[model samples]
Target: MNFAKILRACKGMQWQLSREYAFKSDLKIKWVRPEKIPCTKPEKSGDLGKLPPVNEKEFLLDYKDSRELQSADPIVQSLFQLGNNRCADTARYLREQLIKEVQRHPLDYGSMEAKLARMTVRIRIMQDELEQYPRNTKLKVALKELIDKRKKFLKYLRRWDYRRFEWMLEKLDLVYKPPPAEFHWITRKESLQKLTDAHCEKIKEERLAEYRNMLDEQKIPFLEDAIKKMEFVRKEQIDLEIPVSVTEEQIKDFKRELEALKSKREVKVDSKK
Candidate 1:
């Protein structure tokens, strides 16, 4: 054969493949996928603290501070409180409350507390929306990005002004969960393989225990049969006036072991009953 023929003969050698080239696990087991963490916290009450009072729900605009519609006309006030409070209205109210004490001036929006307060309000609103409509992907993405931005701001605040950072966290009732040093993804194959190994080990232990019990069950019967055989041989030898291989001490030892095994079996049976 020429070199071309030899190459053609070796081309279809699929049977010569080694398992090292492919990712394969010896164990086969099923494992449920872990649930992914959500960007918005629906379970939480809110990051901006508790809800506003029932009576003041409609009048989201600040009546005391802004002096909005300064005249004390009951009809105008009733008109202002006509509709129910929207999320934006609530967020605006909460933002003003958070920034009222911390602001250096009426327009100190650049301050650390003011920035955190804004982010917190938006976060709370988004979380509520997410709870109502969980499948809103665009909102989910926006919330995640906003959360990351807030984390960065919080970290900066912590590094520069730690006292204010502590105050901000307490005021917002927010937990700062820092990102891990490294991120790892969960793979089904690896997880199932680990579970399979553990399952095999458990099965091994169970089967070995059963085999031990089987061996133990046969111990008394084997001892009795051996004692009988030894006695019969000793009797036959004695009748023929020959030397005996089985001694009285050996027979006594077998009888003692048989009695002990029988007592143990009886105890196990009684315990089961």
Candidate 2:
């Protein structure tokens, strides 16, 4: 609401109050009522009414710059944008409250510092939400998380600097949507899938080369040859029996043996020729 509109509304309210009191003129009025009917005068000449116009270009440019902000989930981005105005106002209010709290209880440095940090982070998140998707659903969720997280973080700072908060908000400008086309152009799932596929292919190629080297060097025909080459053979194929009385400790010892085998053994037979 602009200053002029607010004054006009107040005047209308006053007229209504006067009418109501006139009906109850029997009551001894303590204060002097208005002599003439309530009417709003023309707004003062220098009082430029209403908020200054938003700088769409500068705003959009800031929106273009935020890479981290743009990386937000689309749903979340939208929500933030949707709730921007309220989020902005709320953040300012919360920060102001925190400031007052800090001033009121200066000696309680621990609690005051905490609240300051919390309010700062909250303000940052709210500012980000407002910048990106003012009034968006994503903004709402971000705002909530931001509030909760910042509140938890605030338990540390002794003094507050709102400029820091504003700078952080400016850094967040890129979060808003409709974001510049570059961010929205690529789908996360698709990009991840592409990366994973490439990684798998690379690993498969490496494994294939390793196996090929193993086969070529050892002249092993198949996996069975590889396994047989790794086995130790005794002269008479002596039947050695494991102690059936193997205790739990013995089993653990044997388990470590297998692990060592896995680390050190690679079946490679020397060519007879």
Candidate 3:
């Protein structure tokens, strides 16, 4: 029985290891919903073969290529020609610029720094276009997506090469705001505390207002009467005519008088109503 139990434990450990490996491997493939797919859907359901096969190279090429074609510049015109299978000129220009900035020899298209540079340029272009056409939602969404991608790249670069991450940000003239370290609990607590304080303040204000209105209805000089009573108490203390206990008694008497006045005003208002 003990031998069987040990074997079962070993099998469980092995299964856990295999599950982790599968999860890690699955993360390499970018997941996308059908609606959020970056490419256009084929017109015919059976024309799947006509669509280009999804591959890393093709995906990177599509991202590096610009969608604009109305530019008078020759380079822009060449990069955005319709029905082009690839954006050779645009990719070459980006590669040359990134290679010079990194001060490295020719690196693969999949290099992190190279990808970061491409995303930065694309985001900058999209922002310029957005400034020109403020109502273009498509450009805004594309810019947001590009910023998210750049943030991920920044995280990766910061982990691997801290100096390189700083360098990239400076070179691109980008501002990197790190995400908050705390979870949702801190934010929720702060929001709840603010709401509670506001509620208590509102209740306090309403009660004070009601108290003032009650005083006004009674036609009693509440503020002036309190001030006079306080002044009389202070004068007695300075003259050594009354002790502290006597001053306290005077305050209590004043409070009793106000309560009686308020009750009488309430009865009169109720009878009138």
Which number leads on TM-score? 1
Q: Candidate 3: which pairs clash?
A: none
Candidate 1 backbone collisions, by pair: none
| TM-score for each candidate, following the candidate numbering | 0.51, 0.20, 0.34
TM-score leaderboard ranking? 1, 3, 2
Whole-model lDDT values for every prediction: 0.75, 0.45, 0.60
Candidate 2 lDDT over 1-273, as tens digits, reads 799999999999999999976854643323333254211111211111222233222212235467765787876555434234343544444444444443436455355443543445354544544556655666656555654444334322212655544433343221111214565445555665566567668889999989976654444234334334333332123336543333445445545655544443453232322
On residues 1-273, what C-alpha lDDT tens digit does candidate 3 reach at each position? 599999999999999999987964654433332343221112211111221122322223344455453334766454444234344444444545554675445555567776776666565555546658878878777776667767787888899999988887776655666667975533544655565567668889999988987766655576447847686767778789656534656676777776776787788789989
lDDT of 1 at 216: 82
Q: Highest lDDT, which number?
A: 1
